[model samples]
Target: MPTPSYPPKPSPGDRIAVVSPSSGLPGLFPRPYELGLARLREEFGLEPVEYPATRRMGATPQERADDLHAAFADPEVKAVVASIGGDDQITVLPLLDRELLRSCPKPFFGWSDNTNLLAFLYDCGVVGYHGGSVMCELGRPGAMHPMTAESLRAALFTSGPYELRPAERWNDVDRDWADPATFESEPRSRPGGGWSWINADRVVEGRSWGGNLEILSWLLMADRAIARDESAYDGGVLILETSEELPGATEVFRILRCMGERGLLRRFPALLTARAKSWSFERPNNPQQAARYAADQRAAVERALRAYAPDTMAVFDVDFGHTDPQLVIPYGGTVRVDGPARRITVTY
Candidate 1:
């Protein structure tokens, strides 16, 4: 495959497409969706253009693909962002027109299930973004996290190397988006312990490859996004993070092991394991339980690495996945993991 190039950045006044290529949670909870749209206009100074499937829950794959095609094909649309991510986005992958998107590459930002789209864009030779969902990040309860807002602003407008900073205060817990009371106050967060580096011996620079762990597992099962030639990932940084579903440590280990079995795990020399999302509305884990969850997840990762990529350098708890104060990572773009300096930088 050819080297992936960064898509053009959008100006403040430019229009952006906000579509729900996956799940349309905006229909179920309009509060955050509207608030997110307002922020896009007021704070970002960008007009958010929503497609028909943007707020329509249970939109079929064809409808979502049509919205994506329309969004990318429109000259007025300078960027494309997801309203939110949900399951079943893998179904939409088959319907996308590679040549159409390649003809008009735009910065696409979304995480969680949107991993499918990012990976797809990478293979299409266009760089996408791995964060900044509308309802979750922009419409975050109370106010946007300072770190998140700053990182997103830079990615949206600028194109250059940007150093990533670990969040001083991070949140794993989430409030009910459906409840009006959830919007009255900010979600709770805890003091961050910063990132922990393992095998911090050398710096590694390469494009990023990987996303929400569970989502990637699904893609692997479907034989989607991931390169058939394992060498396509050679020297690239592997990024992995779990979502709010709170899959157990054993599950994490099993998935990585499967990748290793396929000769895909040891290709990347470095790994950036996102801070695990510990608390969820379904499983309101206490502080102690949350800590255990994080610890076990880390242990599982270590166990898998020892068996597969034993020499790979790893940095755990980087705030970029399902965590609050999410950082924007450049999908298919350059990432410099400076193990010796204990810093991570990405090309925006």
Candidate 2:
């Protein structure tokens, strides 16, 4: 596979394509979507161009692919950003025009279900930005977290090495987007206890890989995105994080087991796992329940490591994925995981 390269950065006044390759949550919840667009203009000084499917719910894979094609092929569209993430983005992957996308590479920014698109861009030799969604970040209630805003700004406009700092305060809890009152204040967060490290005796630096754990499991099952030979991922930093669906600890272990069995688990010399999102509207976990869930998830990860990548260094809760105050990671870009200094940096 060809090495992924960073696409050209968009200037402040350039246009950005706000395409919905996934679900059109923006149509259902226009409050946040509109706010996000406003911020893109006011704060970032970039014009957001919405595609036909951008606000259409129940858009088919073909429709989504068309939007993506138009977005990337348009010279005026400097970058492409997802309105929000959804479950079926994987279905749209097969419909994408690889040659077109390869010829007109753009920096794509999104996380969660949009991992599908990022994975596709990786194979196209383009570096994508993970963890900068419209509804979630730009439309954040009250205001964008200082750290998140800063990290995103750096990722979007700059091309250099950026050091990632652990969030001083972090959260996975969210309020109802439909409720008008939910926009009145920032989501609650707890004081961060620094990231937990296992086997922090060595430094690992290489191109980064991995995404939402559940999405990756699905990709592996569908024979999508992941390289044909696991060695394509060797030496790369592995990033894994769970979503708000809150899959059980047993499920998490099983997924890793499958990857390990496929010889994919030991490719990475280092792993950076996000803080688990234990609380969701479906299951509103209390403080104690949240703690137990986190513990179990971490333990499951450790168990998988012991069984398959015992020598891999891991750091948990480095402030990305499914969490508030997220930091943008450059997908397929260079990552430096320095265990001795407990510092993680990414090249944007």
Candidate 3:
């Protein structure tokens, strides 16, 4: 197994390339995209440079791949971030230049479908960030969540262990990006339930792995980017989260069952399950429905663990994915899960 190395951190004044590898949501919803870029500059002190397909709708996979190549190869671009996530980034994976990306390693920030690229970077021995997309995190409704901003700041600029705190308040309901009123104020968030632990009797520290649960299922089905040898991921922390699509509990368990069947579940000593996103524009789930969905999903996860890696320490309702006030998880970087101490820390 190849050890993943942390890429160079970008200073405040450095140039960061923003590309739309998945969807060109920026083109469709300019308000949030522009707002996110402005925050990148005004708040973070970093200049955002957009690529050719960044704001273009329906761009070809090759075009998106080219933008990624250009961003990583550019000496002036300190890091690369996705404008937003889309469903078809899997198509762009084959077109990427493996050698070029490996040679000019830089921090790439994204999640959801961006899991494809993050997995690829991991295979190439580079660490990638699992959260901090420009539109979602940076352009968040009215203002960035303080916890989110702080975590991203450390992940972007620092090179050490950063503690992960459960969100004081978190929300998964998304507003209409097209509506002007959506950005008028912060998204409505509810009191956090804090993290739930299972079999958390020991501490486990390992390089992080995993991403969007559905995206991971896609990667597994396609047999792309995943380590050919299961041992490659041995001892790595599995970081997983559901997206706004809000898959059913049965679907979640089936996917984990498949992984377990392939002898993949026992590799990880610890698992970090992000808070399930139970609401979507299409579903418009009521509060009761949302709670039921999350509960079912958690039950399915617990069943899988009991059947496969029963002793694997597990934590749920973590604010690391899809939820408001998301924390950045370093893909292929170090994650220390101290069950006894009730603390989670990641190497940025």
lDDT of 1 by residue, 119-234 (tens): 99988899999999999999999989889999999999998999998888988878778889999988877899999998999999998999999999999999997776769889
What's each prediction's TM-score?
0.99, 0.99, 0.99
Once fitted onto the true fold, the runs of candidate 1 whose alpha carbons sit more than 4 angstroms away are none
Candidate 1 residue pairs that clash: none
Each model's lDDT comes to 0.93, 0.92, 0.94
- For residues 49-159, could you state the per-residue lDDT of candidate 3 as single tens digits? 998999999999999999999999999999999998999999999998989999999999999999999999999999999999999999998899999999999999999
lDDT of 3 at 298: 99
* Cα lDDT tens digits for candidate 2, 192-306: 8889899999999988889899999999899987776668789999999999999999999999999899988899999999988889999999999999999999999999999
- Which candidate should be chosen as best, given lDDT against the real structure? 3
Backbone clash numbers for all candidates listed: 0, 0, 0
Per-model root-mean-square deviation over C-alphas: 0.8, 0.7, 0.7
Q: What is the alpha-carbon lDDT of model 3 when measured against the actual structure?
A: 0.94
Model 2 bad stretches (over 4 Å): none
